[model samples]
Target: MNRYQSNPLSLFGMVLWLLSPGIARADGHQVSDPMSLARDLVHRMTFDQKFILLHGDLGVDFHTSKKPSGAIGSSGYVPGIPSLGIPALQETDAGMGVTNPLNGRPGDGAVGLPSTLATSATWNIELSYAGSDMVAREARSKGFNVLLAPSVNLAREPRAGRNFEAYGEDPLLTGTMAGYAISAIQSNGLIATLKHVAYNFQETDRNFYNVMIAEAAGRESDLLAFEIAMGLGKPAVVMCGYNRVGTVWSCQNHDLLTRFLRQELKFDGWVMSDWGAVKAPSDANSGLDQEAGAQLDKSVMFGDGLKSAVRAGVVSQQRLDTMNENIVATMARQGMLEKHSSSGQPAIDIKGDTTIARNVEDEAIVLLKNDGNILPLSAQKRLKILVVGGRADFGVLEGGGSSSITPYGAGIRIKADGEGEMGRRYVDYLPGSPLLELRKALPNAEITYTDGRYPSMAATLAHQADVVLIFATQWMVESFDAPDLSLPEGQDQLISAVGAANRNVVVVLETGGAVKMPWLHDVRGVMEAWYPGSGGGAAISDVISGQVNPSGRLPVSFPRREADAPRTTIPGFDKADGAMFDIPLIEGADVGYKWYYKHHSNCLYPFGYGLSYTIFSYSNMNVTHQHDVTVTFRVRNNGRADGKEVSQVYGLFPANDGKREIRLLGWVKSGLRRGEEKNLSVTIDRRLLANYDTKLGRWVIPEENVMLVIGRYAGEAEIQFPLHLQRAEFSSLDMVKPH
Candidate 1:
């Protein structure tokens, strides 16, 4: 059980040991410690060499500026000082895969995992790590060191464009998932980036708007997710967001970068600005270690302007040295400074990586509604199945933006209508044709497909089948927030038309986030497939064909209507270009399910809500609280089918001076045979039970009764246990854990 010791029997142990920093080797040398190594390297560097480490070119340099000679044309690049044995920080956008933007590296492609939200939905930390490691292996093969990924930002705003790229709304789930991902990347000797360090809620005018929330609220919610991720992963880099946290830009914000991230969260890595995030040269003095994509910024402050500031004594030499040290330490911590061998390294396992992606997607496909359990598509019955719409006959839809891959089969691409790179965003689909997979799943069944371009024609085609599946999609990406929650491009009308003709209509949603379902009652089944990556087609077919039981829970709630959300309209949607807008989060930490619970509003589907082909029932529940609250419950697979079930535990913390924490304490996913019963125990994450106290400057767990529930979803408290807890306070979150 020693954290420092590797357990051959435990894959988790191996992961920790592989990723844990300062672990000494047999030669009495710390495997990857940057402190001593970075200090020595910095002392030997010339002023010109120091500046080389400070900034670099965009790997996908579309600008007129000369691209850095060392750039690999990935995402960001910084030249290495060969004299100091520093490796060039070759960066890549790794939200899902090793991106070759615009096919910059001709004929280059890598396997893409399911959307991050999909991975988070699985609630399987082990799988999260494995998927990330798969991608990391491919990244290292392509000679990239830094991976900008495992985004931990809460999916509080469902309409937020990049929600598909991040984890989920809950701090506990998102953080834990990201932690494992970060661990996996770093373990593979790549610098994993835990990014967008603060509240980067929406993409509308991201560079001009500010996310206004109280410090305490920010800590308990968004910042809390980052805190847990950092504690578990110790990621090599923390990318500053493009938005403003309060009055100052996140990169230049003293409290965000220095106080909260560096001091409070105890992040050892340096802070790098998002591509062109720095506003001024003085922003460097506020804790930005490096400004990547210098050309993207208006002033190129981290470049020529930074040099001027250094000469004018506006920025100290000591500060510059510290910045250099932080960057080198991260690289050194991963042994990037040392000469390594590829002789022993394994080749890229594309097939193996694809399997990992499919496994995650299989678990991530949440069955929202399955009336009469009309799933597992009875192979014994010679049935006619019709699959229509969303071009599933060709490929499965993936969210657009930098995270997208050209995919293995590389079938189709529908370019978006706009101006620059964001304008060039396309409604891309990965190479996983669901129609083909479904046909393969049920060879005996007669299946046909239509594009669903016309409502009446698709409806007519629906009448000829035993079951009709409408593949609905809502494409979202960076630089644009979804106008609303409804499915776009007349898909809803198509579904309605098809549903009117077929009673057994199933709407398979391949959306970026939640979408309004007006035809909910009309459809027999609903599946939230999310933006399934390269392996999506097979993963979707796996669940519908009952090859794998659906276990994915809603990471974010689906509101009945867009009005039910905290923000009815995106903050800066209608504002003028240069005018700064504010996203005042008065709801604060009461986000996601908490906000709905607080307002007593009803959502179409609640967080942690999912269905299986089989049924599960809970009993024999017991709760106890000492230093931490522990719950033990019995779960039985009541139905005839063998299946996996995700038991979510929700807790309503006692009110503390009118504030309380309604959060997910923990969850366990288990596979049980038909009629089998098993007991499960969860040691509540004490951090979720506590509230961040601004005045006291600490986390405070109040003395009050906690309303606990072992439920299938957040909306239900089917099994309840009310327990009282004494007041507890921790000056540091690290002190709250059991030693």
Candidate 2:
């Protein structure tokens, strides 16, 4: 039996394997302390064996050997010492699903969930856990033990290509969602890695730049997000990014890796370097436990070099011992020390998994505009519907790069680096298409489909239909930042021509991040269906056909143009060679809606902004305080249809507090029947009201009157209530426990 199922200790008790160190083994047998066990294992190892364990060992095996009967291609692998009873650890890519190519077996690869941004839009922590659990289960079924996922970095840059992989600008939202995902992944017997640590907010020359920001600025924003996730999830591993923070690379920065993550946040996990991120052997003492993918990239910084450095007293023997102990302890905590293998060709619960994906999309599809109630298109009217552009007949556009997954019947698009393209790309398409699903859902309507190859031709076709549904696509790939927010491949021009040709037009945007909607005023309705996953097609069909009401909200604010961004210009050079420069986070803690509110700027769409098909009224608000602040309110679906409303709460602090800004304290999703009212309570963590006082070396909760705003969106609120906080301060680990 698998230790995960048969072990007697509860999940929380298992954490004592690191702390108590005197607990009995999984079997009914007495064992030495975990530190003694790790030290004993290290004492038996030779220099060569220890050297091999420090870096990656999967390159030769993956390139020249055959994979296991049900395994996918390797992401990272480190061979264990067989004589010492340690088993190898196999890691896989992504948050959505297994992305590596699987062995030839039925259901080898699994379906994907919606993007992190989409799930964040739902503002439901339980749903986030369910989605991440599904992904971890599929990964374990494919013989993987570690999932490099739940990127918690803030979306500080609007043009970042990998925004779909992470939650948005607000630290509370991003950290809360990531905590749920990490807990879900590890709870299913897989190790979850909190990745791209610190400020990996942009992809432009990411590997060739240093991020310069004040310590206080980081403590309030990006760094705070990491602390919140670490406190809640207690992830098994943390993957350091490639960039430098200040003068040292993040993989080897003692202040970030040791002083902040370890000493302050109290994260007990091991730290690993991003692929090819190691730069020096002296990094052994900088809090990095292992170097991954160095062998594949042909990097010679660690390995024999580290061993020699330790032998020469350049890198201390104590440092090497500490690293080895951290790795072994983490493995033991995750039950990876035993013989690990998957049940071949897992018996997939098709219906259950599909429902999970569909429900997430149902909650995440944002309706930006529904002028004159043009949406929920009347299927009973038997009207002519023209579905043009966005390659909807082919597949949904999956987010590009390392996190891309191959669904049951997915297709591939290979675009080489040429002309204006930034890098070589391979994009996978979700199996089912929206056009086909829409046809299946509304069989009574005259539904015509087109690839929209030519703008003029597409416009001509739009004129013949009673209503036009133009699909606009914006493709985002890793290793580069988008040059601008404009839709790629002249998609804006196509939307303009189609909107001009038909007055009753609705636009559906398939994008990784925010894109400029040039024709927003011209269209009757617009939906931001961000990179919805395998079940996206059906979700969209349900929303447009009035089968499911749209409930998703924008996680990040949408600006009218590039200049409206907090930082107009980012540091970059034309050359591909490795050159370094400093990229300063000038706006500091002011990001997304905080920046807009502070500057009084014009925004295309505000954060937490989404239109629902049914109208919902908020009333009878009340606030209570214990260890945390709890807000209760009555929500009634006033419109004639049943729908779900995401109620958000924001804290408005005194204007004199420059270090802090208005924050999303908490949110809840309430599903109501027509004219039905339900009372819901959302808890606001008291820690959010505190600010890190560097001088005092603690989080200080000031005694002041704070106005809590219950809002339909970030900028627009329905009601305001006041609270008085008594002055208090807390140590680093005070709020680490789950609220």
Model 1: per-residue lDDT, tens digit, 1-739? 2211111113563456454543322123464446877898899988867788888777765847655687777878888888778888889999888888866677888898999999988877777888998998888888888899979888878899999999888988888789788878877788888889788878889889888898888988898888777767777788998988887899999898887776766666789989989888788778889998888888678777888888999988898889999888777767787776545566778888899999989989999999987787876678899998989998788888778877765658887877875667777788879999998988889999999889999989888899988899888888889988889998888888888999999999999889999999889999999988878899999998888889898999999987888889888889998788788897888888898887888999999999998889999999977877788888899998888777888897755447544688887777788998888777776777887788888888877788888888885776889988788888654632210
lDDT tens digits by residue: candidate 2, 1-739: 2111111112322342233212222222334455567777887877677665677643224445444322235567766778887666677776877765323233456778888888888776767878998888777776777888889889999999889899999888888788778878876667888988879888888887888887767887888888777766778789999888996889989998998878877666689888878888888788888898775444555687787788899898778877887777666666566664455536667567878987888888999999889898877789899998888887787788778777776465666455543444666678668999888888888999988879899899999998898888877877777888999888888888888999889999989989888878778999999888878888989999989988888999899988999777556736455778888778777778887876777789989999998999889999998777788888888999988788889987764546336778877777788998887777776667877788987888899989888898886779878899889988767866411
Best by TM-score: 1
TM-score of each: 0.95, 0.92
Per-prediction RMSD in angstroms?
A: 3.0, 4.9
* RMSD after Cα superposition, model 2: 4.9
- What lDDT does the true structure give each of the candidates? 0.82, 0.78
| Clash count list over all predictions | 0, 0
User: Which stretch of 10 consecutive residues in model 2 shows the poorest summed lDDT?
Assistant: 1-10
Top model number, lDDT: 1
Q: What is the Cα-based lDDT of residue 500 in candidate 1?
A: 92
| Candidate 2: segments with Cα more than 4 A from true spot | 1-36, 57-72, 101-108, 296-298, 417-423, 573-577, 655-660, 737-739
